[model samples]
Target: MEKVIEMKGITKVFPGTIANEDVDFDLLKGETHVLLGENGAGKTTLMNILYGLYQPEKGEVYVNGQLAKITNPNDAIKLGIGMVHQHFMLVNNFTVAENIVLGREPKKGLKIDINKAIKDVEEISKKYGFSIDPKAVIENISVGQQQKVEILKALYRGAQILILDEPTAVLTPQEIDELAVIIENLKKEGKSVILITHKLKEVMKMSNRVTIIRRGKVTGIVKTSETNIDQLAELMVGRKVNLVVDKEQAKLGKEILRVENLVAKDSRGLNVVDGVDITVNAGEIVGIAGVDGNGQSEFIEAITGLRKPESGKVVLSGKDIYGKSTREIIDSGLGHIPEDRHKRGLILKYSLFENGILGLQHKKPFSKGIVMDYKAIRKHCKKLIEEFDVRTPSDEVNASALSGGNQQKFIAAREISKDPELLIASQPTRGVDVGAIEYIHKRLVQERDNGKAVLLVSLELDEIMALSDRIAVMYDGKVVDILDRKDATEQKLGILMAGGSLSEAKREVKDVE
Candidate 1:
């Protein structure tokens, strides 16, 4: 195999951290090579150096055996290197064609040829089996379609080497499989890919070779054929990692939360959550399983008081709390680990100590007659940092200073510390690494064992299956079926999630246990 890209002794440093230190990485021609690491482990830093978004303080970069100086994205693009960021950088209001052809627009004399741009986008999308509509607005499309547009944008720029940073982080399982096909097609067309992700399963399924990095340095490089998820996880985290979530059977208790005829609307004023009824009992995890945008977010927001329900009874511990304010709801025994950690879980600009007391800022110990007890707040923050293994330099630092996984851990720690009667954890481990996922799962199960009701909402079916005592399948804003853990399989859940009738799903699978 020919080495198409190589970085030797690459070192990058920030004010307070060595982002990458003496990292040597290489990519072979026409191969899917994964750069695997935990959050803030310098995986993105190294890739940024390669993409010309950041320059290495020291080291050499070689493209096709020739020394190259890529000081900007334009330079990298000209050198046949294109990168699709984790967050899709498309203008939401723009059409897919417009986004793809923004920088290099095809023009007929003086004006941009819109039709030609659309045609070009369509051609590339078809060639790569992306199935994207060129004329569709980015905001109106599914997250998966928007991702394909990002890929199309890179491909349209004549890229021979593509870097996808956490591409599957926001995708559904079906979309993930579709992306695998897209990658295979790209490889068949002689294009190389550098995949930056922490997902061990995807790395195993998609990569030809895997390079494991931990704490700013390469730990091991191995052929995918010879490596397993366990080995890769140990390499990434520098310890023996527990892949399976260990938990005993649930000991059900009285209902902690009950939602009857829950109706909620999206920003557009159209009902997204339509008459959904659900309940979570103490000492059990009732996981809501569905594809994203299938009313899960609205349903959670409705119950959490982030959004008011149109018509529903949200009973918390037998008390109807639907119309209560968010703070009142929290005070009335609810802990929410919101779906968007940055937006709802923590204030990015606030110090970790301040963020630690976010939902509980009005409570005792931390609050005394409207004057905050900074001493107590700091004490609590430090405790959470130690307890949750939040890897931060200090409590005085801003929440944004921490890594994604650390930030998530901090939020979970703060929420769990509240010891609320009903805990609503929405997409708790969405973008976190496997190690953090393990910790978060254990914490959720611990809460259950400690006689707390946990309502888990996640798009990852496997996660729901592993963690839930019972699975509630939601489709088109309704609970299609709630099955016991013993009766729930991925296949059955898939059918229910796709709006299959409960009877049809029941007929497809034999009862277990």
Candidate 2:
């Protein structure tokens, strides 16, 4: 193997923190190398340096065995290096071809050549085994398709070395498999790839070599054929980790939440959540399993009062909370961990102490007659951080200062501290590392054992299967089937999630038998 990218003695520092220190990383030609680490462990910082987004404090970069002085993205692109961010940078209303060739468009004499742009995009899509419509609008496409467009953008720019950051964070299971095929195709074309992700399963399945980074330095670099998930996890977290969820059987109690004939609409005025009926008991976790955009978001919104239901019954703790305000709903014994932590969970600009008491700002101990007790608030925030293991310097810093995983842990700590009777945790561990995932899972189970009703909504089937006492499969805004944990399998859940009825799923199994 030939060395394509090499960084020696790389050290990047922020104002008060060392993001990366003396990190040595290398990638070989035509091989997929994985950069695995916990959030804020300097994985993205290191890649940013390579992509010329950030200049390193000290280090040397070599491309094709020649020293390179890349200072910006344009310089990196000129060197055949392209990066696709975790968040897709695409214009929603523009056509795929337009977005791909926005800056560097093919022109004819004096005017933009739109036809040539589309033709070039189409040709590149075909070369990479991608099935993308260059003329389709970005907003109208699925998330998976949008991701392909991001990759195509990089490929169209003549990227020989591609860096993908958390590529599967928002994709469905089927889309993940499809992406695997695409990666194989890219490898067949003899392109080197650097994958930055926290998914151990995907790391093992896709990469030829794994480089583990802990804190700000490389801990170990091993061949994928030799390392298991456990070894990789331990290397990243600096300790032995429990990858499996451990919990005893639930002891069911009275119903804590009940939703009957729940109907809700999306921003487009269409009934996305149509007539959902379900119940969560006091001492159990009832997980809703479905692909994203299958009415799950709307369903959760309808119950949480984030969006008003068109028509439905949302009863919480024997009281109908149907038309209540979000605050009233929260006061009515409901603790909600929203899916989008950035959008709904925390105020990025506010101090951690302030975000800690977000919804409860006007209530007792935190506030006295409209005047907040800063002392109490700081104490509460400190306790949440210490109890939840949210790694941070101080409560005085803004919420944005923490990494995604630490922010998530802060939110979970605040919500669980409320001690609500019915806790609605939506995508609780979506982008968290394995160690954080383990801690979060244990907390959810502890809540169940403490006689609280937990309503878990997640797209991760492994999570649904591992954490739920009963699994409820949702399809097109309806509860297709609710199965006991002992009776549910990934195959059966997949069948139901794809809009097949419970009877149809059973019949298919019988046919196979």
Candidate 3:
């Protein structure tokens, strides 16, 4: 196989940080090359340079054995390279076809020809084995399908090199497997690929050659089959990494979070959350398992004081905090890990130190009387960054400078570090890398073992099962059934997820037992 692309000695410097230094990367024709690194490593920076998002201070790029110069995204695309970013770039109101052909639309006489564009996108999708609905609105399609549209867009632009950035971050296990097949198909069809991810399993399973980056330098490059995950971790972090977290069994305590006939609705007055009753005991973890939009949002909102239930009661530590203000609820000792990081978890413009104290800094030991203890706040944030492994150049750096995985860790560290009596963690590990997921899982479970109540809601069933002392399957706004960890099965949970009765669920749960 011939080398399709090569970048050597790439170095990118910011105000006070060298994001990449002497980074070497190569992509073979019709091969999937995986990039592996820790959160703050220079992997993304190197890719950004390749795609023209950054102008490397010193580097040389080769395409098809010929030296190439890519100064902008347009230049990269012109050279048959396309990238699907970590955050999607589709417009909400645009149809799938519209989004796919956004920058390069088919013209009919003077304007975009809608009919021709849809047909072209559909044809390209079929050629790529992507069953995307071209006419469907971007907001109306599944994340997986939207990703296919992104791929189709690249293929439509005649890109021979496809760069997928965390493509499976939001996908289910089934979807991840499906995407792996798609990647294989793309490679078989002679399309070169660059998969940027922190997932060691994917690197070992999918890529031919793997490159490890750490702190702005190339740590090592090796054949996928020649190295184990532990070796890769050491290369990425410069130390022996304990991939698995160790924790003892939990000791379940009295009920700390109690909900009785909770009926909550969105602003549209739709009963998104129907009559639901659930309880979480101190020193226990209760996981809510459901598909997206199955009342998980409403349930969390009602519990976290973001939204008030229309009917029924919510008691936190035996007190009705249902109608309490958001501040009041925080004062009552409930920590919430919201699903949307940008919208709920971070103020990107603020420094990492300040963003760490957004919600709870006013409390004792952080603020005194009328002024904030700024030095104390910085110290606390530094400890959290170290403990949670949040990657950043410094605490003075803006939170937005942190990568997606590190941003998620910041949120998890902030919400979980408090060690509150009751914690509501929704999609707590979303967008985080696999290594960090293991870390966050250990911490959440540790909280449970320490006699704190935890209400965890996640779309990942594996996570729910792994951490939950008890699993509550929610469907159509209610917990269809709650099963013991010892007795729950994926098959039974799937049935209950579709609105089966608890008796039926219990029977299925016992079958697994």
TM-score of each: 0.96, 0.96, 0.91
Location of the lowest summed lDDT over 10 successive residues in candidate 2:
12-21
Mark the regions of model 2 whose C-alpha exceeds 4 Å error after superposition: 108-111, 511-513
Tens-digit lDDT track of model 3 for 1-513: 789999988889987789998888999999899888877677778888888888989989998898989999899998999999878878988999998888789898999999999999878877777777899998867778788878888888889999988887777566677788888889988999999888777788889988888788888889887998888877877777666546566787888888889898876789989999999999888999987667888888887778887888888887778868888787777888888888888999999999888778778778898899899899989998999988777899988898888999998898877767899988887767656777888889788887999999888887888888899988888788888887787887877887887678667777878
Backbone collision tally, model 2? 0
Clashes of 3: 0
- By lDDT, the candidates rank as 2, 1, 3
lDDT of 2 by residue, 138-228 (tens): 9978889999999999988889999999888888898899898899989899999999999999999999999999888899999999999
Give the residue spans of candidate 1 off by over 4 A: 510-513
Off by over 4 Å in 3: 228-231, 238-245, 266-270, 364-370, 494-513
Clashing pairs in 1: none
Worst 10 residues of 1 by lDDT: 504-513
Tell me which of candidates 1 and 3 scores higher on lDDT: 1
